[model samples]
Target: MKLRIVHQTVYRYDRPVRNLVQSLRLTPSVFEGQRAHDWVIEVGGGIRGPGFRDGAGDWIEGWTVRGPTEEVTVAVTGRIETRDTAGVLRGHRELIHPLAYGRGTAATRADAALRELAASVTEAADSLDLAHRLSAAVSDAIAYAPGRTEFHTTAAEALAQGEGVCQDHAHALISVARLRGLPARYVSGYLQAAAAGEAHEAAHAWAEIHVDRLGWVGFDPANRCCPDERYVRLGSGLDASDAAPIRGIAAGQGAETLDVAVNVEDVERLQTQSQSQTQS
Candidate 1:
């Protein structure tokens, strides 16, 4: 599949900010399942710095805006060719040890409730089965509903509420996976809709667990399935905040408001041609 994506983020300040610096993890991951093409990242009136890959195989770039400015915009445009890898992450180079992800973050701390959730799924035949069961349990526990939670909402909080967005689902899954002694991490990315012309939310998020023989395998509780060609993985971390596409700090006390828009569309003609050639 060939996918075209456009993502835009605007931050508005009530008063002029003295300065701003941001770290971006917006580039798509290089793996067996996908490859990036014609990728570009632009920041309005901001200076771009050196680009490098982190230990987790995520592309990182720095941007600085020196100005008493009221607003700043970050835009990304790209095309990616993807294949169905059944959510198995292969051929991706990263230096971080799998055990490192087992460490808990504040957002993914498993309380008594989360511990019980993990305990309930302990009857699985193997680690892979347990991971699948855990994903289903999360989807059953937390219904996918937007505007019901905030960015800072923790996994425990979302579980108690029984509703949250994809980020909450990812956090909840990570919390339980860690409780079960499995290594898990959060993934940030873009998700093309299953059907044509179907609208989707802003950016998408999911979870990945390291399996014994399969290495890293992705699971999306919000979607109740493993990531396929429709998913474009950008980065991974212990939790959502850690894997955020954009993280920044602005000098001054002005309040900030954020607006985000993301569009993921399939290149129908290209896909058709690729499929025909494969069949021939």
Candidate 2:
């Protein structure tokens, strides 16, 4: 299937900021499931710095806005060809060892509740089955409630509350996976639409566990399934903040508000084979 995407983020400040700098992980991943045809990231009134691909295979670019300005917008437009890989991350190049993901960051640290959640999983035939069980466990533990948690809410906190959006689900799953002695990480990406007609304000988040013989496999506990062709992976890290598509700071203090819009649509319905693929 061919997909066209447009993602735009606008930041409005109460007062003009002195300067702004941002690191972007907006580019799509290079893997067997997807290929980028045309892609671009544009920042209004900003200068582009040198960019590079990190060891984790994510492209990072720096942008600086010499602002005494009150508003800044980052826009991304792209087209990509994607296929279903059954949530297996194949052909992705990265130097970081899977064991390295076992280390938990502040956002994914397992607390008593998270440990209990991990312990609740029954033994499975294999690690892959265990991974699926873990995913289902998380889905059952947390109800999908948007606006119930903030961006900085930790996995433990979300589990305590028993409700949150995709980020919380990702973090909670990562924490539980780590508690079970499996390597897991958070993934940031774009989904063609919300699952089950639920409303969403931004992109999407999911968890990836390294299963024996399967390498890295993704699971969307929020959606209760593995990522299929509708998902476009951007980057991965120990948790959401670490894999944030955009991270930045303003040189001077200024109250800020953010708005984001993302659209992913199938663009190749004309071809017979493509129509069948899209229908799937």
Candidate 3:
């Protein structure tokens, strides 16, 4: 299957920014079962009119503009070809290694609750059926709720509270997997539209656990299923902070207003016959 994606983020400040810098992870990743024909990060760099990536790879760019600049807009656009793998990640060449992910900062070590959860998820890795079963168990154990968490919340906090969005779901699953020594990475991406008549947000978060036999396979405890063609991977890292679509600092002081808009429209797209074979 092939997909075209465009994601945009805008910042509007009541006061003009003297300077700013940002790191972006907005480009869709070519991994595990995806390829990019043309992926570019188009930026309105305040004073600079436009900037873009010439090809596919980790990309970074920024700007320092004079004050009196009240708005900054960033957009990522590209055409990508993706397919569903046979529930396995193939090939030795990969950029999604665990050690390579994240803010490159030391993460606070996992606690006892997370350690126990990891044991539970890894205990049933004898077969695909067992893995799926474990995933379902997580789903049954947690509830999805918004506004129940903040940026500093931990897996145990969310689990004890029994509610969270995909971010919490990811932290819970990652904590469990990491405790078992399985290399898991946080995936930030946009899913194809949700089920018919469903009111859904435009983005989703999940985890990919690396197994001895099956390279890297995705598990979405929130939805109780493996990632299919509907999933378009953007970036992966140790946690959500590392793979956030945008992270930055603004020089302005007054309360700033920010708005983000994301649309990943692939309506009427059906899975391809060979989706089961393609794997990055």
Candidate 4:
């Protein structure tokens, strides 16, 4: 599957500001299930930018704007290719070293519950399918609910209460993989839909396991399945904080507000001029 994405972000101010700086992870990442064919970003205001790579291998852009500015617009357009490979990822072959994704970040710490879960799950890994089975077990153990916590919430807390969102799911999975000496990374992306017939809103996130021969393979614990053509992977990192699509701080004292709008639809249908596109 191929997709074209448009993401727009705006900052509104009650009073004029002086300067601004931001970190952007908007650029799509190339991993096992997805490929970035072509991509570009456009800012419609007075903004200066530079590109850099972060510790997690995510493409980062430092953007800054100067003074008394009312608004700034950042638009990203791109084409991505997707494939399904449940067998390509060989998690059993790769043993975890304290190099890349194994190290837990300041925000994402493995609490007692998470450590206990990992210890119990991989203690008797007699088969190569332990990761998958453990992932499914986590999905079964927790329920996906919103308004339960903020973005900075911890995995141990979620697992203790048996509840969380995609971030918690990914965090738990990453910690478990690390405990078992397998490499795992956090993935943030836009899910086309929740389930086969369910409605999806906004953005979605998941996790990827590093297999020696297969490289990185993704598993959507929220959906209880491996990522396929339906998923359009955007960026990946050590945890959600490193992989967040957008984050920044603005100068001011009054309350600041943010508004974001995103539309991820199949451009093939719209371009092919199908009946559905015509109707839409």
Candidate 5:
């Protein structure tokens, strides 16, 4: 499947900021499951700086806006050809050891509840089955409720509340998986909605666990399935904040507000429509 994506983020400040600097991990991952084409990242009125691939094989680029300005916009446009790999990450080069992901983050730290949840899935046949069971446990533990949690909500908190969005689901799964001694990390990406009017966050997240021989495999407990061709993997980190597509800071202390819009379209569907129109 081929997909076209447009993601835009706008920042508005109550007062003008002195300057702004950003680190972007917005580029799509290069793996057997997906290939990117004509990808572009633009920052309005900003200068692009050095870029490098990190140990985790994620591309990071720096941008700066020498602003005494009140507004900044970051826009991304791209097309990707994707395959269904059954959520297995294949042919992706990375230097980080799987054990590194075992380290916990503030957002993914396991609490007693998480530990118990992880222990509840004790009857798996193998590590892969165990990982799947852990994800299912998390799915049953948390309900997907947007606006019920904030960015800083931890895995423990979300589990206790029993409701949150994709990020919370990913975090909670990561926490419990770690408790089960599985090396897990957070994955940030885009998901094409299942139906035209389906309620799903285009900007989505999931968890990946390392199996002994399989490397890393993704699991999205929020959706109760493995990621497929409809998903576009951008980057991974210990948790959401670390895996954020864009992380930036303004020099001045001006209050800031933000708005984000994301759209993912099936290029094949659009082309089919065009061909049908021509025949008509």
Candidate 6:
């Protein structure tokens, strides 16, 4: 399947800021599951700086805006061809050891609850089976209820609340996976909604666990499935904040308001529209 995506974020400040700097992990990942085409990232009135691939094999680009300005916009547009590899990340080059992801972050730190949840799934046949069981345990533990959690909500907090969005689900799964001696990380990306008017966030997240033989396998407990062709993997980190597609700071002390819009469409739909226009 082929997908086209547009993601835009606008920032409005109460007072003009001196300057802004951003690190972007907005580029799609290159693995056997997906290939990107015609990808572009633009920051209005900003200068593009050095870009590099990190040890985790994620593309990072820097942008600087010398703003005495009140607003800034970051826009991304792209197309990608994807295939289902059954959630296994294949042919992706990375230097970091899988064990490195075992380290916990503030958002994914395990608590007694998380440890118990991890221990609840103990009858798996192998590491892969255990990973799947852990994900299912997380899904059963946390109900998917949007607006029930906040950006800084930790895994333990979300579990106690028993309701959260995809971010919370990913964090909780990561926490419990680590408790089970499995290496896990958070993944940020886009998911094409299954049907028209479906209530799903185009900007989505999930968790990936490393099995002994299979390097990294993704699991989306909120949706209760593994990632398939409908998903686009951007980057991965210990937690959401670390894997954020956009991370930036303004120099001046002005409160900022943010608005974000994301759209993902099938390339076949786009082609049909183009053909109709040509006929007209």
The candidate scoring highest on lDDT is 1
lDDT by residue (27-91, candidate 2, tens digit) is: 99999999997799999999999899998899999999998999999999999988999999999
Error of 5 at 184 (Å): 0.5
Model 5 score (lDDT): 0.92
Cα error of candidate 4 at position 186, Å: 1.3
The better candidate by TM-score, 4 or 6, is 6
Poorest 10 consecutive residues of model 1 by lDDT?
Answer: 193-202
Candidate 4 residue-wise lDDT, 1-280, digit = tens? 7777766777777776656778788876555656766687766555757787654556778778776576777777777876666624321223344357778875457777777777777454432366686687679767888878668887777787888898888888888877777778888877766766464666778888766545676888888888776677666778888778877776765355677776776666567788667789
Tens-digit lDDT track of model 3 for 40-125: 77657554323344232334355444555788788777777667774355442454454343222223246666565546654564
- Model 5 pairs whose backbones collide: none
lDDT (tens digit, per residue) of candidate 1 on 31-143: 99999999999999899989999999999999999988999999999999999899999999999999999999999998899888888886788889999999999999999
Root-mean-square deviation of every model: 3.7, 3.5, 6.8, 3.9, 1.5, 1.9
Better of 5 and 6 by TM-score: 5
Q: What's the TM-score of every candidate structure?
A: 0.94, 0.94, 0.77, 0.82, 0.97, 0.95
For model 3, the superposed segments whose C-alpha errors exceed 4 Å read 47-67, 95-109, 120-134, 195-199, 267-280
Which runs in model 6 stand beyond 4 Å of their true positions?
Answer: 194-199, 272-280
Q: lDDT scores for all predictions?
A: 0.93, 0.92, 0.64, 0.72, 0.92, 0.92
**TM-score between candidate 4 and the true structure:** 0.82
lDDT of each residue in 125-163, candidate 5, tens digit only: 888999999899999999988899999999999999999
Sorted on TM-score, best first, the list reads 5, 6, 1, 2, 4, 3
